[model samples]
Target: MVVVGAGLSGIAAAHYLRSECPQERFVILEGRDAIGGTWDLFRYPGIRSDSDMFTLGYTFRPWTSDAAIADGAAIRDYIRATAREEGVLPQIRFGHRVTSANWDPATARWNVEAEREGQALRLTCRFLFFCSGYYDYEQGYDPAWPGRESFAGRIVHPQHWPADLDYANQQVVVIGSGATAITLLPSLAAKAAHVTMLQRSPSYIIALPARDAIGRALQAVLPRKAAYRLIRWKNILLSSALFQFSRRRPAAMRNWLVRQAQARFGPTVQQRDLQPRYDPWDQRLCIAPDADVFRAVHSGRASIVTEQVARFVPQGVELASGRVLPADLVVTATGLKLKLLGGARITIDGQPLQVTDALSYKGMMLSGLPNLAMAMGYTNASWTLKCELIARQVCRMLNHIRRQGLDVCVPVLDTDAGQTRPALDLSSGYIQRASGELPRQGSRKPWRIYQNYLLDLFSLNLAPLRDGALRFARRGETPR
Candidate 1:
């Protein structure tokens, strides 16, 4: 088996493959030189976990750190430490970017093609797991404005932050109101003369504590593993409850969230900058640890402007309202361009597999692809929650196939599979932009991609692997 990444998802998959199926041999192919995926790639200021570390970290490993919302460097170290401690570090082949994978039904194997230092590298594996992230690393979603070249100030995208670019005492203006823009405002305000966040619309923002006091107390009284489990579950349940509340009572949730922000910032700031047009959970809520963003605004170090950009002038951004926001540096923290399977092309035999044509079975494997599983995370909760479930399910599938003497297992969707929708349930701009390019999800069991963790825990881990939709067979024989 081959894993296409050394990130959190890949590490989780490797752990399950080693412990759950010790007899199976596996290798991890990493595109970059490091182990951490997103954490390693993004080097911008205030790069931290958007979700709490308790749920984002691996289930097997304990995040003993005091900070629940950890920085990018800490998360990167944690990933490296996990890979090192599990002895999977040596199994990772760095600088190996997988370009294409072809599944041969005759041999029931995937002929993986990759590039290593400008050289072609090929290998065959019975199972192929895609743990790479959903976004295109080579490019982020930097929308073309009217006058990009007219800006005299330095323009930098968060995806490709220049190490040498200094913002000390420099006026900075960050575009977009997503997680990246939220995290950057406070960090940049600390050094920059002034920081301004320009956004087309606002998102729901909730401030949480930087450290987990309850987790610390639990660790002091209980065993390490026990404490970790309790803390993890507490977070999981609380998040799920919040999500349900947001969905069931959108108006109430919106009011409560706005009130919370009003407490952190003044009523004026809350109404002007924090209140979103859409209801809560319409998209993923942005987490502001320790009320850093609120503090930045309250201290008059940073300001938020919700308006349409007319164009980039020589000194700053000219808005549609005829107001110009001056800046010495423009950081576009907009969002990522969604790309499936890390921009790697997937095919069945010689026929191209357009993901948009198939349904995502169990949120792990595709409808027409066999012997392959992808680690796509949830849009509502911590990413690793879904990734971990997918890994454990992959292990179970492998074990079941071996026990049943089966060589291939593919999900077959019938014509009456029922109504279908986009793979992701979010209304975010990035998801909406990739509307017709992504896969679909059915309205029925094992085919619908539930965003709830508890629901997936049962549907993925506890449910029967021999679900009728997942067909199995021996090589050269008709699928059963």
Candidate 2:
């Protein structure tokens, strides 16, 4: 088996594979020289998990930290610690980026090619697991604005923050209302003379305490393992309920969210910037830990400006509303560009695999794709909540294949059985931007990907492996 990536998903895959299939030989190929993929790469101000650590942490290992929302360094260290303690670190090949993979039906193995230190390398594996996340790492989504070259001030994207860049007592403007923008507001405001969050549209912002009060209290009375399990389930159930409530009663959810925001940021900020045009959960809600962003706004260190950008001038950005915002630095917390399967070229039996033409099977494996699985997380909840479930299901399928003496397994999509829909149901900018590039999901069971945790728990973890859509075959016997 070959696992691509060393990030949270990759680590989870490695941990599960080692525990379930101890006899199987596997290697984790990481493109970067670090163990933590996103956590190690992103080094901007106030980098932390958008989801609580209870769900984000591995199922096998409990998150002992008191912080519900952990910082980038802390998450990175947690991943490294897991790798070291679980003996997966020695199996990792850092700086090895998978370039292409070709599947041979005759051999029932994949000829994987990777680039390491400017040299090409090859390896063969019976099963290919794609743990590489669905985003471009080198470059984030930064659209070209008119007169961009005319701006003399420093412009930095959060994905590529400079090491020695200083903004103390300098005017700064952030150009987005997403999670990154919300996180950056207070962190930048601490040192900068003033920080401005300029957005064309508002986003629902909810205030969550930095520490988990209930979790901490539970730990005091219950055993460590028991407390962890309790908190994990609590978060999972609460998140699931909230998501369902948002869909069932969007107006109520919207009103409740607005009231929460108004209470933290007061009516002025709520009316001017916090109240989004769309209903709650239209896009993923941004979580503000300890109301820091609101505190910054109230303290006059940070302010919100709602307007469209006209263009960049010599010193700063010019608004479409005929107003100019002066700034010594501009941070484009724009977004990420999607790159499925780590942007690797895939060919089966010398035939190129068109990902867009394929339908998603159980949101983990692609249609007509054999012995391959991708760990994609929930859009509504913590990412690892879905990823851990995917790992378990993949392990179960692998074991089933071994027991049945099957050489390969692939999902067969029958168009007549179900209707096709967009891969993701979310209206987020990032998801919509890459909708055409991603695989489609079917309307029926197993084919459709549900955002609800409880629904996915039954569908992904409990469903039988021998579903009608899945085709199994022996070596040298390809299913037609």
Candidate 3:
């Protein structure tokens, strides 16, 4: 077995595979020197999760940190600890970047070509699992604007945040409305002389902390397992109910959310920039602790400008509204472009696989692929939870294959009756732009991503292994 990426999903998959298939040979090929993928890469001041650690942490491992919303360093430590505890660290080969993979029909194995420390190496494995994340690790989105090179001011991207770059007593302009932009503004306001959040459009903002004091008090009194379970279910239920209510009655939800923002920012800020034109939940709501961003604006530490960037000048960014915001530094937190399946060139029997042409089986396995699976998580919920579930399912499938003497399992999508629209209906720039590359969900039970943990826990975890959509074949059987 060959698992690419030493991140959360990859580590989890490797741990499960080791336990389930002790006799089989397994290797983890990680491109970077470190084990934690995202947590290792993204290091910025006040870097923490948008979601609470209760739902974000692994199901098998409980996060007993004093802070429910863990910082990047804490998350990285957690991953390392988990890997060490599970004893999967020894099997990992760090700095081995997989270049390409080809399947030999005669051998019934994958010929994987990778580079480690500038030397080429090859490995053959019966199964291949891609847990490498979606974004481009090589380079994040940093587009060049006209006269950008002439700009004498400092420019930075959150993806590649410089360690020595200081924002103290400097005028900063953050250009973007995504999570990164929202997160940085409040933190910068504490030190920067003035901060301006320039956005092309507004996104829905919601306030939450690591954990509420009330939640903490209740947890202290309740039993450990019972407290974790109750909190998990409460969040799941509340989030689901609120999302459903918003979708059904958008106007009411929008009005209520707007009023909440108004109450936080008062009349002046509400009149100027607090109100958003689009409906609530149209895009992902940017989460902040205790409405921190609103409070920062109310205290006159930060301000927002709703306009498009016409171009970048030597001094600062010029807006379409004919306003030139002077800035000593500019940080573009625009967004990321989705690269499907870590930009892997997947082929089966000499034919390349187009992701859009394929259909998703159980939202993890794809059609027309043998002994191959990829993990894609929910945008609505914590990503790691869904990923952990998929990893367990993959382990179960591998175990079943070994016991049944099966060599290949291919998910077959009947295009005539099976094709349907996507599951998520959000206007995120990344999602909207890359809709063509995303996998198509089925109209029926197993193929859809319900975003409900209860449904997925039963369907993906407890369900039987034999499904008509997945076709299993023996070693000598030919492709039909």
**Candidate 1: tens digits of C-alpha lDDT, residues 192-222:** 9999999889888899999999998998999
**Ten-residue stretch with the least lDDT total in model 2:** 266-275
What TM-score would candidate 3 get against the native?
Answer: 0.94
Which residue segments of model 3 deviate by more than 4 Å?
268-272, 275-278, 415-419, 422-425, 478-480
Per-prediction count of colliding residue pairs?
0, 0, 0
The positional error of residue 151 in candidate 1, measured at the CA in angstroms, is: 1.2
Q: TM-scores of the models, in the given order? A: 0.98, 0.98, 0.94
Task: Rank the candidate models, highest TM-score first.
Answer: 1, 2, 3
The CA lDDT at 185 in model 3 is 86
For model 3, residues 343-367, the per-residue Cα lDDT tens digits are: 7676665677777866677778777
Clash pairs detected, candidate 1: none
